[model samples]
Target: MLEYLTSLNDHNLPYPDTIHPIVVHFVIAMVLFGFIWDVLGYFTGKTQLFEVGWWNMFVATIAMFVAIIFGQFEAGLAQPYSVAKSVLNLHTLVGWSLSGIITAITAWRYVIRSRNPQKLPIYYLGAGLILTLIVGVQVYLGDKLVWVYGLHTVPVVEALKDGLLR
Candidate 1:
């Protein structure tokens, strides 16, 4: 069972890179750009940009869930060093919470888009800005997990295999 689970990270497939980061960049780009395009559309009265924002948010809503799934899978396999445990736990919590938050916001955006595709309400834009801010914080947390704590990196994985990391 342990061998089977560890084999999922074997890097033998066509896309050998970590799956979480691949999926997550899509979420990050879509959410941030979706908010940006919406704000620009609101201020400049460009209805076309609203279309762009709506689509971006819609795709981001989906991609964020995919990213969260891979994140949970990879995090489960991670054996972080003692000092890194709290940060990993926090990142996992935020990742799951962000998934739910993005889903709710996307549903709200869908309603607004369905009613009137051209104009977005100020409250919705405000909420999107807040969502973008939260995403930024999540990005920071993810960076700390990978860069500062070195989770799943080659060296870290080697250390784990050698029982050098707790």
Candidate 2:
């Protein structure tokens, strides 16, 4: 599987496989979104998307872990564009940190949800707040990579240079 993953990381084009990094970006975004929405809903005395089906959030959180692994590899060593290695390293570190945060939050929430579903508002609120802040930081770091660190913007010359014809 490690070899398979390494081989798959090279096809950074826009094909099905090539688009995986983009999907990882989305997974990060969605996990943040879900966490934030749940937090806001809790404070406002409202019900959010994950408020009902905690199971789905668990599944998505797992998916986020997987996506982050793939994205980290691609961001570090995927072909062409040649993003700054340090910047992507920062991205990977931030991602792993978020995963840790999510795992801890998920565990705490699991205990809370199973104990008393109706009275879980307070516990959920705290978790949501922590998660929101973490995600917010992750988003900012991502933006920095894209704009300032050249992680997101690929030079056309590099793209063409990496093209098969070249």
Candidate 1 stretches with Cα past 4 Å from truth are 1-15
TM-score of each: 0.90, 0.66
Query: With candidate 2 superimposed using the best TM-score fit, by how many Å does residue 75's alpha carbon deviate from the native?
Result: 2.1
Cα shift from native, residue 127, model 2 (Å): 2.9
Residue-level lDDT of model 1, residues 1-166, one tens digit each, is: 6665345443321235578988998999999999999999999999899989989999998998899888887777776779899988888888888889999999999899889998899999889988988898889989998899888777777777788988
Best by lDDT: 1
Q: Cα RMSD to native, each candidate? A: 3.0, 5.5
Best-performing candidate as measured by TM-score: 1
For model 1, the run of ten residues with the poorest summed lDDT: 6-15
Residue by residue across 49-141, what tens digits does model 2's lDDT show? 446436545755787777786676556444323444565676678788777877777777678677865445666666666777777776776
Model 2 residue 2 CA deviation (Å) reads: 18
